[model samples]
Target: MTEHLDPDAMLVAYDAQLRAHVPPVLPAGVTAEHDGPLLRMVGFDHGGFVVPYRDLSGLDSAELDALIARQRDFFAARGERFEWKLYGHDLPADLPDRLIAAGFEPEELETVVIGPAAPLARPPVLPEGVTLREVSSRADLDRIAAMEEAVWGEDRQWLAEGLEKEIAADPDSVTVVVAEADGTVVSAGWVRYVPGTEFAGLWGGSTLAQWRGRGIYKALVAYRAIRAVERGYTYLQVDASPDSRPILNRLGLASITTTTPYVWSPAE
Candidate 1:
């Protein structure tokens, strides 16, 4: 006989499995801090918490409220931007309203897709003059960061620092691939393979306007997929934007769910 799992229980199991498999690359100064049963980070940029509500098995309302108050104090002390990455299924009894009352603002939602890595190994062909290469050196990382900032309209310091830490912690699990033509990085992406999990995540797939629809992104995906398979990961996951959704669909990945990021800023 099969056992039935409650929806909330199943979500908690999934969240724990994913988090255990892939430890988030917490920013510098952010240390793993716990409040009661809540596992979170504190003392980092404006301070935030992971707040695994799905796994809040032993917590009472008072404990939960204290956790929120702690987070609020942490943010107020530093006067920096704060973020809480909450999932749709993680809606506890009154999370949204409480967060809003505490000054958190919601951001756009993105699809979370997971599937076997085989399809990614067979990415579509790239247009002429476009070629894919894995970046292993600091100089290559700098180039990739520059291209990313150019395409996404942001500074590269955050990404550069994050990548540097990842490389220092476990170089083999992270791969940065860039698509270049005519001596410029027109397209780029990266993947992080969790050491013990079946999941490998693709991130930072940025391409220049002129380079879209030429299969460069797909090729980059393929490159990362190949890397994931090489590292013994069976599944590839991506928090995809609408622009990449159709291509990922073509590659046989299904949308498992959505992730929405809520931000709290000092200015607000």
Candidate 2:
């Protein structure tokens, strides 16, 4: 068995190698601008997003407040839902409180779990009636989108649009997977390999409520881990939700830190 890593040191290394060294994930023709330490991404597949690419370990109160307001205005003028990705180690000692005061609602607090992808590639022992595979057909696309929507209780338009772009490009950087039972998609997930980095992100690991207790979710993670190793990615990372954190931890991924998204939705 592989030894579990020290979470703090691993998170520091991840911030440097993956978060700072790589550009924000965006489709072709979409662009982002850097303002101080903030990266303002526009026209990304899933609306607008703001990332603090580096540590904000030195900002004063006034400056921090201005930065938050600037980000809000940048997205508000574009009429986009803005997501500010926040790490647990973010500076000023009260960043989360500031974000909430700025009308940014706190989303789910997720554990930043990461580990070697190869170890997670063990053959998935799925339940008797279920099968897992890479999704390819348009019919499967719709099914996957529907499954995600049902699981999250949200619309799947952005998810579908993002998946379609990835499918059309076939860039080998992203792959979508789904679990099916009796011809219905019961769970769906995807893995995105970031260029110039050692990490691949596992996202959208959602299963229908009724399919919760089965091993379907674990099977999906294993399938994606194998795919990540195939693409030469050393680490598989995920912002694991509360429901999935224990499962990932059991699979040997370390819960390095907590990450939360502060969302500021511009008036529609």
Query: What's the lDDT for all of these models?
Result: 0.71, 0.82
Tens-digit per-residue lDDT, 1-268, candidate 1:
0022233443343475675232555534556766554566654423454555454435576776676667766767777666776666664647767677777788888877666786567654889998888776777778877887887787875666667666765677689888989989898888987755667889989898888888888888888898888888877778888888778867777666677767777764
**Scored by Cα lDDT, where does model 2 land?**
0.82
| Model 2 weakest 10-residue run by lDDT | 20-29
In model 2, the Cα lDDT at residue 238 comes to 92
TM-score of each: 0.83, 0.92
Clashing pairs in 1: none
lDDT score for residue 231 of model 2: 86
What's the lDDT for residue 180 in model 2? 87
Off by over 4 Å in 1: 1-13, 20-30, 42-51, 55-62
